[model samples]
Target: MLTHPTLNQLHALGLHGMAKAFVDIQASGDAASLGHAEWLALLLEREASLRHDKRLSARLRYAKLRQQACVEDIDYRTPRGLDRALFAQLAEGSWIDAHANLLICGPAGVGKSWLASALGNKACRDNRTVLYQRVPRLFSELALARGDGRHQRLLRALGRVDLLILDDWGLEPLDAAARHDLLEILEDRYGRRSTIVTSQLPVDQWHALIGDPTYADAVLDRLVHNAHRLELSGESLRRVRAQQAARTA
Candidate 1:
């Protein structure tokens, strides 16, 4: 049956819209016909390529990307003084193997979230498990967890992802229990999994956001070590876009 020539076989191979007439002629099935074997070969090749494309498409959709998000679309190279080589190195899976984390710090609208989300997208595409959470929303979930007595289970779910992306950090001050939860998540995942954190504030000010000196110090101590840190400096990309629009008008 695999040796027989058929239009369905050719369509399966890759000539996406081959007319039924062509297939009907091919499927006539004369035993000595070389056309059948040729068509079969073509179909086999097309099937392989289509399978590859399907796999790639599945990976992209499984990424669960936010709107207008992707690392490839991010203008990292356009950002002045940003290290492309370092970004490439991190993009490779080896950085995680080395137990290193990534910190994407910059002013608002400077592509910090774009970059972090891009990396998370990459991890997902690589078939590694990932989770994305905004700090405020995640903390709110944690607050609910505490009320429902499922805080530890929730934290464990977070800790288990191969990569975790925490976006918009320092947006709100942490109270004692939230601080403890954050620290515990970091410590538990520390050296076991990797994290990508995006924040508008400087690392020096993280102490201020966490609010408890002792706990903040402990948190910083674990995060800063064995981490690949990138500090971005530039005007807001949104403001730049608006200015360009006005100029065009």
Candidate 2:
């Protein structure tokens, strides 16, 4: 019989407390111990940690990205007038090294979100850290954190993420404090990590949406200074899909 070490010994070896439950079940030879379902459950439980691993999420978000969300899936071979060089940069993973921001600016339905999300998913897959949040959601979380006296903690947490995606930036106007908080977050992460922002409004009008010129300038300076600007100038891929479906019908 294999001798079982005390839980303290496991802890000394850096095993998580949750590992005790698995050990207990295994020792007792419970219904779950030797079953495939139980094995899968244990695997999934371990994966729960990935949700909090920002670096891992960032990499997986990129590596395991869905094909539909990728720019490579779109045909640049045709004379559709898409920016080929930008696509090449994205494909080459240059942004991953430069720690530069990615600005996806274009009209709605032009696959801006798809491309940004794909990149984010790719980052997650590559074992880098990443988080995805809409502009409104991010502001709301920060506001709640501030109200709860955890604003600094929240900012620090955002700073530590390897890649942060702020999607739908122009969906709503930002107030003074919210705009300021955004600026701080951007400045903190400036050249330290990467950020991918998808916006319908052009960079020039970002100040108008931010609602404060000085803060907006400071924010844009950090964001645009070391960023990869990809203007997704194409018709809505959704529209194209619909048209193809109709033609098939």
The 10 consecutive residues of candidate 1 with the worst lDDT sum are: 16-25
lDDT values for all models: 0.77, 0.72
Q: Candidate 1's residue-wise lDDT over 55-77, tens digit each?
A: 75765564454544655675765
- lDDT for each residue of candidate 2 in 42-159, tens digit (9 for 90 to 100): 6356545634564554455543332335544666653334577776667566676677888888888876766776776655555666667778878898888887889999888778
Residue pairs clashing in model 1 are 13-43, 13-46
List runs of model 2 lying over 4 Å from the truth: 1-81
Model number with the top TM-score: 1
How much is the lDDT of residue 178 in candidate 1? 87
- Cα-based TM-score, every candidate: 0.75, 0.69
Residue 135 error, candidate 2, Å: 0.6
Prediction 2 TM-score vs. true: 0.69
Q: Compute the lDDT of residue 95 as modeled in candidate 2.
A: 79
Model 1 accuracy (lDDT, Cα) = 0.77
